[model samples]
Target: MKFGARNQITATVGTVKTGDVMSQIDLQVDHPHGMSSVMTTESLQELGIKPGDKVRVIVKAIHVLVAKE
Candidate 1:
């Protein structure tokens, strides 16, 4: 799936932490920096994500629109 104009990186779902809330799904990705990522129910489903499932991780740089009020 093309998100805007940026490319998405293909990665595998290494680990997952499912919280008490059904909507809370924390995922640990096998990144070069040992970095992890956060994903929501909608996003997870969109990627067809599951434990041991493969998914694409898109990294985007965004500017802050507004300061914390």
Candidate 2:
């Protein structure tokens, strides 16, 4: 996959919190600070994200995206 965001991190999924419309994903990264991302619940389902999964964390100026491959 081609991502314009240069800042990427390899992280493990720590938690997934799903609301009615959106879901929040917490990740365990190697960096000092914590990292998390939010997306629609539908997207979460499509990705099949769960705790302990390894994901690619994409960091842009205004958003943090989680990609499961």
- The candidate that wins on TM-score is 2
C-alpha lDDT of candidate 1 relative to the true structure = 0.56
- Candidate 1 error regions (>4 Å): 5-7, 22-31, 41-48, 63-69
Model 2 misplaced regions, further than 4 Å: 62-69
Model 2: lDDT of residue 4: 85
Kindly list the per-residue Cα lDDT of model 2 for residues 1-69, writing each as its tens digit: 878886888899988999999999999998787788999999999999999999998877456456898
TM-score of 1: 0.51
CA shift at 50, candidate 2, in angstroms?
A: 0.3
Which candidate achieves the best lDDT against the true structure?
2
CA error at residue 29 for candidate 2, angstroms: 0.3
Q: lDDT for model 2, on a 0 to 1 scale?
A: 0.89
The count of backbone overlaps in candidate 2 is 0
